[model samples]
Target: MTGPVSTDRASDEALAELLMRWVPQQRWFAHKSSSAHLQRLERTPLDEGGVAQLVALTVRTGLGDEATSTVYAVPLTVRHAPDEALAGALVGHLPDVDGAEAWVYDGPHDPTFTRALLSLVAAEEGAGSPAFGVHGTSADGGLPVPAGASTKVLGGEQSNTSIVVSAPQGSAEAPLIAKVFRVLSAGDNPDVVVQTALAAAGCERVPRPAGWVDGTWTDPSGATAHGHVAHLTEFLAGSQDAWRVATAAVAAGRPFSEEAGELGAATAEVHAVLARALPTEPATPERLAALADGLRARVAWACTAVPQLHEVAEAATARVDAVRHVTGAPDLQRVHGDYHLGQVLRSAERGWVLLDFEGEPLRPLAERSVPDLALRDVAGMLRSFDYAASSGAASSGAGGEGAGAWAAACCEAFLAAYAAGTGVDPREPGSAAAALLAALELDKALYEVVYEVRNRPDWAHIPLGAVRRLTSPPG
Candidate 1:
């Protein structure tokens, strides 16, 4: 059996039906709950043979006033028989233009597509045709691609797909990893924008930029739209993320304060770099009130989704309101919106490298791109520590007291280091920083409840525990 002879409109229509079934199964797909009707936006053949296709889809989901839509780029490789390795990434079997059965595999998991992506990024190709486009630059303005480089897809990613490409044999250059953004939006991605700026500013706390890939397409409205589709960075060869390290330390009952302190300082350093590289603004009472309102909205939404949050709703709202009334709030600036231990890597050469500046991908890009109180990041990390403690205690069957103590110690140590580096005492009693941090922490925990409830019901208890404590009266 031969693969598709040509990727025409009819073939694309047949593939769209199959994609509706396949897309929702993917971990990176955004709208799992809604019924999706995929409308073909564009389909381009990457190779002259037409076996590999770059597809852009606009999925209209939900119905009536509840309707929503998102655009996605799904590259696919059509073959008669996919290799055993590609079995896990199979989209489905479909008939070719000649009506012969063919197998389709997701592009990021396919070597041919990955290589094409690498070539595009390396060559800095631009959109010469309506169907093809690419725009990216290396940190030092040069992309280096070693010959015979191969890609290995990473697992456990929730929102985006990533493939790690090895350096060519005996090459001194570090390995590269490309993150393919699942959801498509026009304009600069904060992950690429912020990391590039930080690297240019001589920041040592982020993976050096290699290059990126973007594409352009004519939307349903007949307007040209461009979007960042992927990003590449130097892969730390033998690094482990702080989440794994912290979990191990908790299980071993070892003090994680030293590492936590280091990570805190590293976070502060990144914030400082961002403040210098990007715009900064003083926080007014009005801004503080707006921030508080956002927090209250999140709490309300989360409580509606996970009724468990109802227990702590009032107290959470109160803490959030305290921020609006505070007289002196710290300056607002661009901060990592979804900071946690998992977002950091402990490299052998670089102590702490922050990854993923994309922020909460579920939020609108405009909201994620805005300057926020840096303490929001601090609050997220503080909540992460609690989650780690709770998970560790569950596995080890330790008492609640021990878990609480460990989390408290780690949070205290982390805050001390962060405060010292940034000159912001967020934990100081009755301070605006204290009120803001508490409110953010509460909001984060509530947000966690919604995620955990949807994804991992058993893990809901971890954040729910934090919610209870946050709402409890002071001893």
Candidate 2:
């Protein structure tokens, strides 16, 4: 066993210098191009009982313009003796509180921090210094750490660090996944809030909610800001994401209409439960007009950004007008804003499971929390079908005609299931619902066009075809 490490040498200034150099290299760091400067704002002990002390530092990331700087939580672990096993986790050597030189590490990689973090979250609280006004709290069913359990960090995550906790081999303790937030903002993470609520309401479409770590820290202006630093929930061990499943079926030349319909029903079930378990309000005319206004601007931008959109500009404008002139739009409610195949999982035990309700990672939390049309989610999923078909056809050496037919079948089947589940058909000719669905789908495709043009120019053709199809008048 390692001896307890002291933190006397890890001064805020010294820590800041090391972190500024370290933060930019991390996969979770948002600002890659901008030079980063760290101003240490708050330090709170996440766990002091273990051999290593897990110190939590809330810092303002980015150098200039205090108002625009983003808040990030940095957890650093101090160890008396460096373990060769943790060579990849090393931060730098720093002296301990006793003036003895010690080793520091990134928290997620070190067992000291990961173990303590899960334990504290199970207890639903990490008693940080009240003087710093920061702490972590858990909900009703937070993480429970069993004996002989080990944790491994999940990789390829761009925005947060996720650790999976499980017992020794063959043990029955269901595993748990914990997400430590790298970027901090001043609102409850929607993943925690929405999934917790739905789980509490006994919705089976989403994994059961566990809990989260929340903290408060002063910003550059000396004002208090609070946000979730970490979140925990149940992990479906053998589940596969929808993207993988759909693509496989497509490559095998199998009809995915049945599975697509099932997924649509699952999505509608989640939507229904969310409306019942959370807040909802009528979509006021002002809100509809504002949404239409945004769509108009996007339409214009899409035309300019993707020159191919010029051919469909008039049709796109007509759809936007339909949105603006609609009466009795669907009631507004909290929705899975970033609904795509990637945001869901397919479990053998549970038909279809949802994940990541936090919406678009790039959008502000406040903006994402606003109620929106459910068709927006419908639009996103429909686009995912198209993506799956394209990928599947390419992989299986099928003609483009086969890919288009598969996507269209999936679209029809999914929409039919959704209409049956919700008791509201969105495809009624000349109806406001029909018009809005087309507009939202066009908007999603247009956004995709911009993205593909910038990131994957060859892929622009996919969304451009969608724009033409969606904007064209019904035959």
Highest lDDT: give the candidate number: 1
Off by over 4 Å in 2: 1-10, 49-67, 94-100, 131-138, 141-148, 169-171
RMSD of each: 3.0, 3.2
Give Cα distance to truth, residue 216, candidate 2, Å.
Answer: 0.9
lDDT of each: 0.81, 0.78
Which residue runs of candidate 1 sit more than 4 Å off their true CA positions? Answer: 1-7, 80-85, 98-102, 141-143, 218-222
Worst 10 residues of 2 by lDDT: 1-10
lDDT of 2: 0.78
| Tens-digit lDDT string for candidate 1 (152-179) | 9999998998899997778876788899
Best by TM-score: 1
- lDDT (C-alpha) at residue 467 in model 1: 83
Give the C-alpha miss distance for residue 94 in model 2, angstroms. 4.5
**lDDT accuracy of residue 468 in candidate 1:** 84
